[model samples]
Target chain A: MSSKHIVVIPGDGIGAEITAEALRVSQSAAKKCGFSFTHESKQAGGAAIDAYGVPLPEDTIEACRKADGVLLGAVGGPKWDNVAPELRAEKAILGLRKSLGLYANLRPIKVFPALAAQSPLKPEIVSEVDILIVRELNGGIYYGARQEAVIVNEVEQAWDREGYSRPEIERILRLACRSAIGRKGKVTSVDKANVLATSRLWRKVANEVAADFTQVEINHMYVDNCAMQLVLNPGSFDVLVTGNLFGDILSDEAAVLSGSIGLLPSASLGDGTGLYEPIHGSAPDIAGLGLANPLGTILSAAMMFRYSLGSEQVAAMIEAAVDQVLADGYRTPDIYQQGLTKVSTEEMGQQVINRLK
Target chain B: MSSKHIVVIPGDGIGAEITAEALRVSQSAAKKCGFSFTHESKQAGGAAIDAYGVPLPEDTIEACRKADGVLLGAVGGPKWDNVAPELRAEKAILGLRKSLGLYANLRPIKVFPALAAQSPLKPEIVSEVDILIVRELNGGIYYGARQEAVIVNEVEQAWDREGYSRPEIERILRLACRSAIGRKGKVTSVDKANVLATSRLWRKVANEVAADFTQVEINHMYVDNCAMQLVLNPGSFDVLVTGNLFGDILSDEAAVLSGSIGLLPSASLGDGTGLYEPIHGSAPDIAGLGLANPLGTILSAAMMFRYSLGSEQVAAMIEAAVDQVLADGYRTPDIYQQGLTKVSTEEMGQQVINRLK
Candidate 1:
């Protein structure tokens, strides 16, 4: 049997409780698939700040770099809200991404059939929304050089640069095309080509990268139109790929379509070790209350199995069990409907375990 | 009587038909309000390309500059799709904005109660969505300096600059605060302050500018969160102000929530002349047919009356008649429901004219 080593960072707030359940599920899924994995706990975010005087301790980074993959719970809370800008709790995740060289952030917005009624969109529209947004993480304006407010021509001004290289665009687009091949074989490369020079270059490179994957059909859409389409006709998209800034905006917009944001999972990937986490923030208000949902974290672990552990079967098994658990009418308090069986975080994980075959 | 001089540009495709109806509605509304305005027709867009070898002729620019306000129908069609980049029909609008120094673009996303059912969102969510987006049109990445693809460090790269000065931020924020005074007296300034330097400057300047308006309440939101909030709770926003790029995306996203893009109107304003138009595009396919909707163009004219033509009463009168027309179950082809009385482009304009009191 092939064995994998993983680092689990239960960062802050409800992180400890939710991540414990995710670990149990991962173990059970791995056992059922006749594979094995070893994971060790590491502290980051507010927890690390309290333990090591830094949001991202060198010890944690070393462990993550050597591990096959990392599973993180949400980070940051009011407790660390006033920390120095460099020592901010949220910096842990950013630091980990930079150290690990994670370049792409993948957000899969899937509305389960049982939870379709919870969507803000009309039922028919929400029912068919299964989009995977591939966001280039390491480049673009978010990480580009910037100027602080300074006097120029007797007026205070500030600026930021948005740039992309052919290599950067090619890699992300290639990943998007590869991702589409496993799904509906459609990729929508979104940019502001009509207005921005960077977007024009991105579009050109996207076309070239997509050509390598003949099975995948690729199209380009302006960011503005894509924003509207995500709400109006979300079912039409399979994979959406864009630069960091556009991705940051569109992914959040797409996540809310399902209405229950607590149930969405995300994965950040690069050439080496990948990072998996729920797209939601640390719900400190509900920390340790047994009311927080564990599905997103559990799903993140599933993504870890498929993308990093090289266990597609275990991934599919875990996902199928999650689908069955929801179909069996088990819900966490956050997603609880009046007539359904409302389960605690531990109970929801166990419910998925019970449904696993 | 205070007589105002206005110029009307009936550009390509459905532009001529819609503008004629809007012009007639303007005349009737002005007559009823006891205000007088003199108007002249000007050519632009593809029409001007054919007549004067340019999308925006010098004659049209001079006429628009001399007028108190300008009303334009939609521009661009397939006929001008292959033109040189600079001579494209769309360039007419850009040129006009530059020549006239229009720095603010106002897009009011008001969902008529009768048409709430048309929204993709649950009726309860979208029904209360009446947001006015005040976009800074002259600056940000769209107008910033850029680099086309070039070999940097032996890799082809492209970049665009996003810069904002204190004066630009102050002017737009002041406009937003003033605009909010007439409505809900609340302004949500959107930016990406946590990540970008420009956004930080914008936030700093926004607070300083908003202090001048005691009647207005202002709050700040990160652009990513704002994008999600637009879908999750659009009704919570009164007047949303932001830089150019973010505004371009959000305004288009907000427009589709009403489900009838054809019924949306827009206005671009500056220190001197202002331009008004519908937010929808010219439907070249349905050009000569009576299927086009004229409410958007008529509403644009009404906006002109309020903002530039100096007649708020006429604006209100036109708006009330529009609401009454919709309430009376009249619908154009694009927004027609099964049980509503379907009216032609011309008849719809007539309906609003008849209801004006």
Candidate 2:
């Protein structure tokens, strides 16, 4: 079988420290499963700016286009804060998503049985929680047409238009349904139809799309109730789909649900290509100290194998290895406990690799 | 001294049960504090619909406008569900708010020390939590200019504008600051300034407003961050002010923070009149069962005294009495404990009245 091609862009700060370990762990998982892997490193963000005077050089975009999947570590730090605001370190991901035509962002929130005690919710509430959130990323308020401050009726006023055409809402709902197909087969489309016109339109589209997926049970809830449920009854939700603004808020709230934001992995997918990465940001102060956590990135590799590569067995192997290591009380500095064994980034990666069998 | 005029609208269902106890509790507090009270009962919701053929009758609005403050119980039930959706039981409050021009909606979330065990969050996290959320109810997305669904380029689309004129934002921020003045002297103005033009305008206006209120410390946070902070650090916030859309979502999230949604109260104030009520809805299932909780409505009466009737001492007296009753292990059915003494709605009201001295 031909080796799967993956693009590695360890953009800045601790990006380099963690991506190396993630790559090692990916290779170990591939070896244990009798599969071959091929990958290439590319310059982006601050590193690309130092070499080519731009955060996202054309060559980097072209390289990602040629690969089957893209794996990114954290991006942005104080050192590049003075760059032109448009060319700042964070734009690399934004530019990549637009250039790759990625629209749906998948963030899975699962309270690991071994680490359920880390969450703020009572143990019983977090015990049975596994949620997949499909957020429509390319449209809505963030990408809406806007006008700067203008005098209206002798008062300073500014507004941004929020709109979602049928195509945008349909694709996202379809993606959410697809995500729920192999799980509990439940999808909850969240909106503010009681207030916003955009939400009413979104809800109409959702109901229309839901009719085609008869096997999946669908529920529509107001965004406010959904936010409360995330805290009050998080175990009740399966797959949640929403517009960009609500998604941004609810996803962050869900990230906080785990109490392990630094160890979470996310995937962005379009109709054609997929991109996987860790959810944390670059830690400039400890960039070279080998103190950065690599589990998020290693898990991102697992996501790549399951989503972009045709290997569910390899993905499951990598994920099980991570679970095995955590069960042994092997902890990184970010998630260290008083009695647990603390390991550096490389050591933690090695522990998982050793458990891959 | 002249007696304060109070209009009582026992709207429907549990609304009648709770408001009767609330009115009784108010009379007890007034008697203990040597203040005279003059009150009138008016019909609204389904009651008004049966008598005057409208959800919000003109006589009810006229009475509320002439009074010093309004004490309302819950509204809406299945009885009026078949009414024209626009003329349903729930529209009474909406009609009242628009007619009364009540722009500032106040919801206080304070986890009572005696009942902190009711919260889903660990007791340690809920121990020091107290928050006042002031939502601008008249403007923002709910009342903005909107275009209904229209096909453009063969795809259906709809949009709602989100705009805040200077005066609208200023008055709400001023109200929030005033709310903080008597409490912790700190305010947090939540917005989404980084992405939305309306939020940027809100942030700029918030900063300008902060300069005028030198005695109180004000901080600005993005809406997404505020949502997470509500769960992660509820105790750190004193007062939160935001536009209607964000507020509608965040205030509900804050309400969940206390784990006693059934025991929460709210107030809506304009320049001329004030309206007070509990945060929960009329549970038709428990309409006249004597099982409804009355503390929330009774507490709303306390807010009425402090905010509209100019009786902070009496308000404090009423609040402390309720707290004492709870501490003594007196529980209503909604909040009953395994071994605590259970009481009917009016019995609990009498318990609070007995503690008023």
Candidate 3:
């Protein structure tokens, strides 16, 4: 058995309850797959602010850097709303990503067959949706230099730069191409090539990178069209990749198509240790009440196993168990339908554990 | 009766057919409301390329500049696909917008009750969607300074600047607020203030401008959240205002929510002549077959009455007639239903004309 280590950050609100369930489920699934891993709980977000006066402590960053992967149960809440800009709870994730050198943000938007009715789209339109959005995290307009509102030529204006380097686009595209392998083998590289210079360069680099992956077929789409297509024909996509700003918009748009955001997980990856988390924010309203959903966190753990722990078997086992659990009609309060069995946060985790093969 | 002179550009493919129907409908509507308008036929797009060797001829620009307003049919077809970048058929619209100083692009996305089933979204969710998107057109990243791919610090990179002036943001927000006055009296200013400098400035200016419209209620939304909400609860929005890039995207996304792009109309307005057109492209395959839908063009004409021609009564009459015609089960090929009366493009135009009171 290969032994690996991980850091867990149960940041705030329902983070504690959900991360506990996810940790237990991860242990059970790893045990079933004959895999062994150790995890240490760390402080970050509001919890870290309360403990160390900073949202992201140096100690936590050091631990995450040394670990194989990190599992975060979200950050930020109204409790930390008044914090200084640099010390805000949400800065923890940004700091962690920067420190860990995490570049690509992978968001898998899949509509579970059992939950298809929950979608805002017609059931037929969303039932077959299984899209993987590979968003380049550290580049593009989000991280580019910006100027605040200032007087220029007698007019007050603010500006931001949207830039992409060949290496940045190449790496993210390579990851997207690799991600498409063993899946649908289709990658849609989205940009605004006709209008933006960075997008034009991105398209060129995308073509160059995709050439190295023979099995992966790639096509380019404008960001605006892609936004419409995600709602119109989401199933037509396999791996959708774009820069930070477009990805931030499209992934959130795609996430809502599932209609159950609490069940979606996200993974941030780079050359070093990856970070995993639920797409939803910390629900301070349901903190410690066991009313929150733990599946997103558990799915994050599954992604951790696949991307960082080198245990695709364990990841598959966990994911299949989750699918079976939902198929069996066990639901948390967040996803509860009238005729289904409504389970609590812990009960949902145990249900998945019992079904793990 | 006051008389107004307008220029009509029947650009390419179905442009001639649709514009002719729209022109006839507009004249009849105006006549019913005791108003009169004179229109001159002008060539642009591929037609201009054929006639004057330029997609946007100096004559067309001068004519449009002097006219009260401009009504355009769809532009571009495969025949002009290989034209030089600057001479492309699509350049005609861009050139006209620039030359005429049309800076605001308004796309009204309203789901016709009779065609609600055609939406990819559930009928209940889409049945009440009526949104007007006010997009800033003349500025933002689309028109920003850019650097093509070049070696920077030994790595090839490309960049584009996204800038917004107080005047630019203020005018668009003012337009949105004014647009909301008669309808819901609500405006949702969408931006990415949490990320970009331009968005922060946009939000600030939106607040300042909206303060001037005391009757119009306004709120701010992150662009990503707005994208999700447009699908999850589209009926929640009244007038959504945003910058150039965000508008181009959200408008198209909202257009698909109607599921009948052929029936959607758009208006670009500024200090001078407003440009009105349908959101759909010219369908060359069905160009001369009378199979194209003309409701979008007619609706665009209706907007011309409201915004440029300064006859709200004529605009309302044209719009109500359109609504009643659709309710009476008259369908064009693009929005046809099995049980409804499928009419030719010309027949559909005639139906609206008959319904005009």
Better of 2 and 3 by TM-score: 3
Ranking of all candidate structures by their DockQ, best first: 1, 3, 2
User: Is 1 or 2 the stronger prediction by DockQ?
Assistant: 1
Q: Residues A88-188, candidate 2, lDDT per residue (tens digit)?
A: 88889999999999999989888888787888777787888889989999999888887777898788988888888889999999999878898899999
Between prediction 1 and prediction 2, which has the larger lDDT? 1
Interface RMSD, one decimal, each candidate? 0.5, 1.0, 0.6
Residues B189-239, candidate 1: write the lDDT tens digits: 999999999999999999999999999999999999999999999999999
Cα RMSD, model 3: 0.9
- lDDT accuracy of residue A174 in candidate 3: 95
What overall lDDT goes with each candidate model? 0.94, 0.89, 0.94
Q: What is the lDDT of candidate 1?
A: 0.94
DockQ of each: 0.92, 0.80, 0.90
Runs with alpha carbons beyond 4 Å of true place in candidate 1: none
Error of 2 at A315 (Å): 1.7
In candidate 3, the residue pairs with backbone N, CA or C atoms under 3 Å apart (3 or more residues apart, or in different chains) clash, namely none
Which residue pairs in model 2 clash with each other?
none
TM-score of chain A of each: 0.99, 0.97, 0.99
